[model samples]
Target chain A: MDKNLWRWIELNEYETPSVPTTMLAKRWWQKMLQTLRPSRVEVSTANSAEEEPKGVEFKFDEQPLLDSLNTLLDQQNQDDPRVTWLVLAPASPAWSVIRKWANQNGWQPVSMPQRDSLLTSSSVDELNIPSEPWVVDDLSHGFVRHPLGIRWLQNFLRKTLQTPQSPGLVICGSWLYYYLEKTHGGLNRQALTLRPFDTESMVTSRIAVSRAHAKRLVAVSEGHPGIAAAYRNAFAVAAEQTEIVLEMPQVPTAHGETSTFVIYALLLHGGLSTFLLGEVLNSIAPNLIEHSLNLLRSHGIVRYQDDQWSVTELGYPAAKQFLAQRDFNWTSC
Target chain B: MDTQKISDLFKTVDSNAALQVVTIILIAWLIVFLSQRLLPRLANLLHSKQRLYTLALIPLIRLVVVIVALVMLVPIFIEPTLKNMVAALGALGLAIGFAIKDYVSSLIAGVVAIHEMPYRPGDWVTIDGVYGEVTHIGLRTVELVTPDDTVVAMPHEKIWQHAVLNANNGGPSLMCVAEFFLTPESDGLVVKEALEQIALTSPYLQIHKPVVVTVNDEPWGTRYRLKAYPVDPRQQFKFITDLSLRGKQRLLDLKIEFAKVETAKVN
Candidate 1:
């Protein structure tokens, strides 16, 4: 199997084999991933010895969710004669573990030092580049917020972005985040206006609000409010295009070997839909609670700490409010 | 003649000594009282868990308070006795050192720990084979809770002696292993490419990225491991679990055969 292919399966490539045993394992894992979407995953492959991974090494970068995606498309990469990189995502805690494990194994030999970004990319432009301040902010505004910190990151990424410059592939929504649509991030400094838990539909609605602004609202006239709310459930409906095949019944792959696929489910009926040819759901335990947390971290809201979790700089206030609503009684009024 | 007896009684009292004893007692009491409110507040605002180190502030505070109070009250206790007091202190210095040897050493160690801040509350640390989250930082001892959830109180002297591993130095991020076994003939290059592709594609990947792809020395086949990160440090198991299971599934779909990795031996 190709190393990249192994990574696809190891990362659960969003789909699984249809055979009985593979299907059973897939379902079990899907259940786990569904329940723990935003949580870290440690797979134990030991046969006889039952030992947990050594306690964590502290300094990790993938605190937020969008950060992982933004990192995937970073500019600076190492030059490898033998290795071929098929894709790259934003750096996340999960990706870090994979890189370290791969290097230790000599699957990528020592002569090849991993290529890191020339400059540390700013989470803002990376997150904010997706048009609509509220759109990106709604995804990431929770974890980090500092002007110098944001600027330092921007200057760094702008430098790296200048290098290995490639025409970006603008899928359904990436265009908006990269400032293709409007002068976003004007009123708001941070990316992702709402908390990470907010749905893609909610983010789109806020994006419409920002895009309309005063002049656009004047142009839209009386239908402005309704037009803004139009995209509320658009992405969610589109997200269903993810043919999870929760029930893999008749996949045509090898026997006794697990198979993963990316089925192009519903075609573009009228609106836009983007699909990733993924191997598995990035998350393991995809429960409702974890779902929200996954959404939050994916958007760069909070972080994971030593055996515990907490909100990042931007998430502090909202998380505190959430705690008040979750732990304390704030509904009486 | 009765006045002579009263003067002799005054000599016995040793007013200066009385003053030092009273000052030490009062300062100690004041320090104990102030610490309850101060320590918790520092832990909260400062986001620290080193209560012992904070508590160490108490003794130092008390010492300062007593010294200041003594400096101001010296004239009242004894007249023109600075020189005489120094002579007296010199005379008793050796005797006092012999008596309070261990106590003085502990006091010094306590002082060093407070200023140095080797560990703090809410930090996961391992010392002398005992690993756990720090619950308290004491003057002479440090308390931590182990992963399986055991509370361990280790001496400060012990932590200083052995190698201490701090898990959450600034934030919690841990290295994770996602293992896969493939048929020995399976192109290691192909597998490496796919592994790299997965790491590149996964939304869980990070910038200060993890080192990846370790090929084992085993004969059954090659082992491809992706050391990736979780969205957060606390979620490492879930992160690695998803990556491993997914990576394996992807390879299988590619008609990849497998030699499952045997049980590892770590001696």
Candidate 2:
């Protein structure tokens, strides 16, 4: 399904991210190629089906497609950041489109170096992701899904980012989208509401996820403008082509990060230093170091010192991975 | 004629000198009696440190007394040498073992069990897939505490043959997974939201609670699985039941339907 990704490997030593749940990432990649080729216009999600008013004759929106193509080519012609774009849709998963876009760009896509790339479905299963204690039964805890899902999703995103040339992207399930964002040190990523039916209540919720933080969450609706005000910034038009800015969304993760930062601050300030100890994060009530630490630890981003914590070595890697594998979800970043 | 003359001549010897036949045997029996009944009382009167080992050492001490008694009896009964008595006892062992075969096997198993330590008093163990707390250790039997707080008595012989898995050997906590299925049409977005909320709100939350979920396509709908941690394993059944109830309720209110989940056999 994602054969073109092979071209990316030949073109770059870097890895091409595997299939991403996000439709935008693949579309962005395709757009980049179309933009490169002045004569060719790629499929636009907004116009692919909509342009066919009464069947028979239809006109595709070539502008956005044209823009993606031009941007990709201009970058390639001038040796800019490999700049692959993509999107997630029913027709395309991010990696599936990444390969197509890469092939069209005339770059030899990278293929599996060995029969055993970890991203392969076979590899993921083989890894047999160690089941967390919470993965099976936390009935001891009243929660429905274990919190480990957030961690796994984050790990999945990180893995996707390792792909060569092709932009790193991921498609997160809407169910775990927001929690993962809130818990991980979510960065300059976009959130996408993969709409099944575009209902009003669902639109409201989607709007909430989109606008919940200052970051721009792209809403992938079937047709309707869909609760326009719910997004951090709304872009809607009854048009044949869809226009998505390539710019990364603003990060509003400060809310989650701030709470997390408090733990890191206390730990570094207290445990790592002498004078700061006992003065701060002393584990005493009023001090309630545990309480503050709990908030910080809830996010997978935090790690511990004597009584302190900070982001892990894996943290920045996660952020970089998030950028590369920008898949659509409750939050794309 | 010689035999008749010897019988007449031997008539004057007292029973004490009657080859010292039964006199020494009676005295040995007397010594055993004093040790069994008298020594325990002496220990109690003196409040001796050996008092703790008394219950533990009774069978061993008794075995020693009988062995000593038999040694004394050999000289009196048959004028047998020390080596000859040992040989006689060894010869009789096959007959004794045949008479009480199961007992002999069980006694041997008990010795193995002491060395093997499949379980000991106070160790939480699961045997024959029966999990519980170990409460008592006896010569032939062991007691366990069930989740329902019932005492389970098991024979030492069973422990020797069957396998027992110890949960606490790695660490007391056991990781468990619970799964729920819903229609693919059921909004995964909604399901994930509800599950995370439930996990955070759960009272039985552990210190390092690791709740997780997976969404897979099923004929009925998306298989939304939630795996969470339980505070105490003993209450696993209740935790599952509660999760089922709340899960059903949460979905019912949202009108999320459950998928009749079953695995397909490829073969």
Candidate 3:
């Protein structure tokens, strides 16, 4: 595997390729053309329905990424024993790579307290940090966006950093990292983030990612691999089709403040179970929360899996821009 | 002066000139109306700083359109001679001084307000006793929509005698304080730390700004002030509510008691 395949850069250093001006102009023209000629769009949609595959799933094996991570880890460990490795991952796939790496290495994974347990003030003091060489697959899981929720995370962080303990690796969702950076001044340590995929890195044999497609993918995903893969899969009509028309996912109109808060909360915590979401946004009605979630899901802004609802990889770009437009604080993707 | 000489000071009244003057006024009104309607909508789509800047342009745009229309219309009504201009202005001044002095004063003050930018649209301002978000800045009056959703139109002349309190002049940052009066028996240090944490964890908090938890000894008890900035100035209420609610809950969980004060003191 190419050493640069999963290059680990600082969180601030991660750069998603900007969508080319030509691509944006092309997209704008296409939208205008579609608006002017709806009949043609209808015809193409009907034809594409039969021609396009049910889904073009682009599932990259996390093993390569883990292997790449291992190479970097060994080099970094050799370079400095005192350094703590913080892996900031995108919110969509949660902590799959970190979990896989921890499992393979037989490293101790920190247990996240139950949501109810986190509700008590004593829970923070009671948090037991794993001895040494422990792995926190996703730091976002350690806390919710509630008052009682963050105490545990704060306590856990203080213990992990201040105590005389062996260096450990912690994986945190980028969104959570950003939120913590705002609220708690963030972790002042060396962090490694996956390099965003650009046109040069995105080309493959199965489906040749055209320059335009790659640019669009990189722009939309902000170089997040999972989001990029989702985009590649969603836009691919056929394996043989050379020209992949990549359109940005449309963000659902956040008609009310509830929807806005729901999306912001989901992103801030890297996604939440409905119950936890209700706990964070306790003032909002449960049905209203459900309504917002359902509405968002219908627009493909969010997805439900493993009893959790997270911003979909494809929807992350639009959702992020949507929130940013409304002056919501966000972490750099 | 003879009637004919007085008549000579003015341009002959013509239907075309009257029509032209009306057309110019109508065009100016349309431009001002559209800007007042459209700019706020555009500003709403923008982020905080840009939103305020865009909103502030509403009054400036209206001022420009009115000035241009006046410049164009003045020539249609009065001759270009300095004597004619002085005579026309003297008559206009006398009418304004006696009939609508306050209204003219407010109009002049409105221009001054635009230049000074004491309070622009989107700014949380207090004039006289009314506190609300400045929604519009008209020629004579500044409109504000209070938290109760009541629209109050304050004359711009208030800027002269009354102090205009602007929470956020043109920036998004606005400090919000959530106060907790705890029993004297409660540990100030512990409550302070808890209040700080509560503000830090609040979703509405603007993390860029500092969160300060100040503890003061009061006659009744210990007053803990959790001060922080919200991501948007408009979220100040929600931010304070979140801080107070969580601060109270956390304090309660800490086994601390809130100070019970008299109803008069509370008021």
Candidate 4:
């Protein structure tokens, strides 16, 4: 009997039948252990022989996802112990998968404490956890407007990297990933973006769905797992009655003489500088053009950035509707 | 003098031939009506920048249909031979040319206009001091709609003796000029920049083209002229109006006063 086989059988909680006396039975037992040995020994575990396996292999429903994640972690562990894996994915199934996988593998998963919690809780208490391979979830929270939150996150990441006991870190969430990359240059971490299931996968997952419905699910969700799951749930209950309504913001009509011209110019050419916009509506008083632009900006129809003006996403549909209602012909310029 | 020869040279008129001639005329009329009506509708239906180009083809299509009808009718009414038709047309053209010399010249000019393409429908042109957009190019006359909404029919023969000023030629865009006059003391460089900015910001302004501001220090005041092209020729007036209004307001904002009317008139 191979010593490594006995270790895998013990780690996987597989029963080690008393060494078979017959040659055929012993060979069968060795072959079965050999098949499971590859999966169990791939990831290094520090489980002691006296410690009993708490859960069976088939207990968890997401066995395939767990297996894949274990393989990924094993590869990452072997490659570089210092590099953290930043997983960018929409919240829901992905976050759950990462949390479960980390927990099962005896790696600590920590989320960014809520803003209110952070204020009350001690930073030392949160950072000093008794586990290796910590997973930081939702690092983007409070980073947008909170300078203190950004400093705390940076400090935490720095401390985590210096700790020899902590093997690695996994950061989750798309916004958090983006915010971290933009703010902290990704902390020199490897990134993995988990995308929502495509149409073919969706069809394979759902037993009772037409191909068209699967396609519609993909479109409606825009490939966000959380949104797709919500849409699927809604579709399941009232398949025929379910309706997706896209509500477009309405653009107020340009009442002033030059307002129409200003809006039209913005619509024609997506972005323009203040100087260029003034030139387009030159017939209107410069004062009036300035006033109109300010008004449009206040209404959230247009945005000014870097000395250039552009209509907002909400402004496009509204402007189109407004222009169509007024019968403003672009053909006549 | 040779009556039998002339009679033989001409095909005898019959009911079937007459019906065929009437059918041809009807079809030609139908084509004319459709081209005049349907083409405009088609141009409207087509949501594209090339709508004007499509509209310009209407007159050409009408002209081709009429010519084709005439050609088709000639063989049915008269002997369809090159030599005979030339002899007949030669005599008829001589008498008609002498009687309507101006009409002949206009007709010939219209033909040349098609080939030369000096002006077409949707062009902004000035012929013999009349400035307007060409709405229709007829066989002998070209119809224009002025800014005042007045329709003027100018004969094609004017192309012979007068120079035609086509602002846009056959293209969709046309240049418009807006003038500003300010006191001599006002900064020339500042005013020029302001005028150029005014044109650059106009909604109807075509940014791809250049916006030029010219200044002249006249005795009356510094004359500032801003020249720019509008995206469409039809919007020339509106584009100019926009530029002028904004330019004036900008000048006011800069605390620049306009030249006195009496002084401007003197210049």
Clashes of each: 127, 75, 0, 21
- Report, to 2 decimal places, the DockQ of model 3: 0.40
Model 1 stretches astray by more than 4 angstroms: A1-287, A290-333, B1-107, B171-186, B190-211, B214-225, B229-267
lDDT of 2 by residue, B1-267 (tens): 255532332334456756564655576567656655655443332111233233224334544555676676445534355655565556568766779666666656655655566664434577777888655554456677887889888766776677877643323244445567776777888788667545543333332445676788855667677776544443355555655655666577667787766778899
Q: Which lDDT tens digits does candidate 1 get at residues B98-216?
A: 89665555555555655665655555577898877666555566777776678787766654467778765534344667888788888887677556545533434432344477787
Docking class of 1: incorrect
Candidate 1 residue A204 C-alpha distance from true site, Å: 23
Ranking by lDDT: 3, 4, 2, 1
Per-residue lDDT of model 4, residues A1-333, tens digit only? 111110111111222122214533643454344333422321111111112322321111355555656655676562344545545333245556666777777776564555434323234234553345666554544232221223455556677556445566565444344334433433555555443445565555551155555555554344444444444443342234444332223343334335556666565444557865654443457887888777666555566878777655434433443443333432110
Candidate 3 residue B27 Cα shift, in angstroms, is 1.4
lDDT by residue for model 2 over A1-333, one digit each (tens)? 111211211111222223224654854564344323423322232121112223232122233333443443444442222222222221212223334444454544322122112212221222121211001111011111222212233344454344333332233222233433334434235333222222332233333232212122223322112212212122332223234332222111323222322333322221222223222222223344445444323433334655434333212222222222222111222
Q: Which ten residues in a row have the lowest lDDT in candidate 2 chain B?
A: B43-52
Better of 2 and 4 by TM-score: 4
- Candidate 1 per-residue lDDT, tens place, A78-112, comes to 33111112221112123334344333322322111
The number of clashing residue pairs in model 1 is 127
Off by over 4 Å in 4: A1-333, B1-5, B44-48, B261-267
Model 4 scores what on Cα lDDT? Answer: 0.59
Q: What DockQ results do all the predictions give, each relative to the true complex? A: 0.02, 0.00, 0.40, 0.06
> For candidate 3, lDDT tens digit of each residue in A168-281?
677877777777766666678777777766766666422225665665666667667677776666666543555666555554444446777888888877788888898888
Q: Ten residues in a row with the worst lDDT in model 4 chain A?
A: A2-11
Candidate 2: deviation at residue B88, Å? 8.6
**Cα lDDT tens digits for candidate 4, B41-85:** 655433224556777887788779978998998888687788787
Cα distance off (Å), candidate 3, residue B223: 1.5
Better of 1 and 3 by TM-score: 3
